[model samples]
Target: FPRRRRRQAQAPLSPAMATPRRVPTILFASSVAAEQDETFVHSLGLNGLLELIAADASFAPYEQTLFAESALQYSRRMQTAEQNGKLDRRVEGFLNLLSAHFLSQAAQKALEYLLRHFRVHRHNSASLLRCILPYHGTRAFVRVAQLLRGSEQRGAWLRDGAGRLTAPPPRELVVGRAAKDTELLGQLTYLGAAHRVAASFSAVALLEIASRMRFTDAEAPLLRSLLEHAREGIASETAPDRRLVGMMLIT
Candidate 1:
């Protein structure tokens, strides 16, 4: 009876005063239990995350790792190795974590790691550039574009200090672009999975990559090709395809 009065006298919870918290979205088949995931992230840190990733072939670990925030020290191991612009094979697992619904600390860490080391090791990171765009959907403008821009800005410079400046051999070109580009954007728009969703997603990604490398002042083949796709997508029976075209127009 006395305890009941004391409990009732305590301050009521104020909606305005409560702290905001992250609401997790399902990214995999199922998520680990809340308490278990919290322990995984805060107790074991990033090493725990890597272990979970290695253990699960499915992307189930992302629920606990990508959306969960860890202290900065957990990332120390990645720091020393990446400091030298080299990454270990085991560390490459972070690539799977990049396909996030919204950019969280975990996603941001993976992004920064990739961009920071992209200049030194392009082949490893560049191979997956096309896949990154579709996962982010409209956020491709922010995440994928930022990644491409940073990689190009940091690595695309032609260095020739001795006055004998020569172009990098053809092998150095970004994926989907070439020394003398053949223009893959047109082909990519219609060449992927037959389903409208998959085709549209892949097409949008290729368009972004191709658009990035296009001549600054000169744009023709791509322009005409783009109009064709836009015309087709806008008139498609699929609502999602039409929506994709609308996003493409503004982007």
Candidate 2:
């Protein structure tokens, strides 16, 4: 009867005091666990942000090195599978995008370099001169025309204090319209024949050099004959039979 009474008394204490203690301890442990989880998630997000910054061009090499070191240090402390997976995906995507951007810039630079070489140095010629002539204004064209005319009359001039002075005399300076046309035709014929020869030689030279340079077919055609008379003048330089042979071979 005494043991039963003591057991009943202890049972009342257990229900009241022990239950409250267990409840508070469980709640405190849960609150601590939740705070730790929040901290871990926050740290993972911060690491991802840092990785994005490192992948950008604005970061210097030294700064990137420091960021990498810090990231490695922080990553070692990460314990959750979910946090690690999220971080890996974010880092991989950022790196892939960054690599593509750099590759695009490199490709653009290479293309520009090739174009500049082809335009400026490789294709410099009188045809290039003529193509650009229209852009130089009407006054520039007129000036060039006057210079060419003066060059034609150069034999009729004498060296004077003011350079060449007309020696044909004022009376002999007949402004014959027909004479002007004849002189212009002659000059044009000469210029055309000379340009034709030059162009043919240049084309043959280009083909030979291009072959040696291992240039693609796309590049060879860009070196087209811009002058019309170049081929005719080249043909006239050789004997008729030899010229025919060369022509057949070229075709």
Candidate 1: pairs in clash: none
- lDDT agreement with native, every candidate: 0.41, 0.31
Q: Write the per-residue lDDT of candidate 1 for residues 165-202, one digit (tens) a residue.
A: 14322212332342123333433444333344446655
- For residues 127-155, what per-residue lDDT tens digits would candidate 2 score against the true structure? 22222122122332222212221223432
Candidate 2, residue 178: Cα displacement in angstroms equals 77
Q: Which numbered prediction scores highest in lDDT against the true structure?
A: 1
- Candidate 1 stretches greater than 4 Å from native: 1-58, 61-102, 109-121, 124-218, 235-251
Which 10-residue window of candidate 1 scores lowest in summed lDDT?
A: 22-31
Clashing pairs in 2: 196-229, 196-230, 197-230
In candidate 2, residue 171 scores what lDDT? Answer: 14
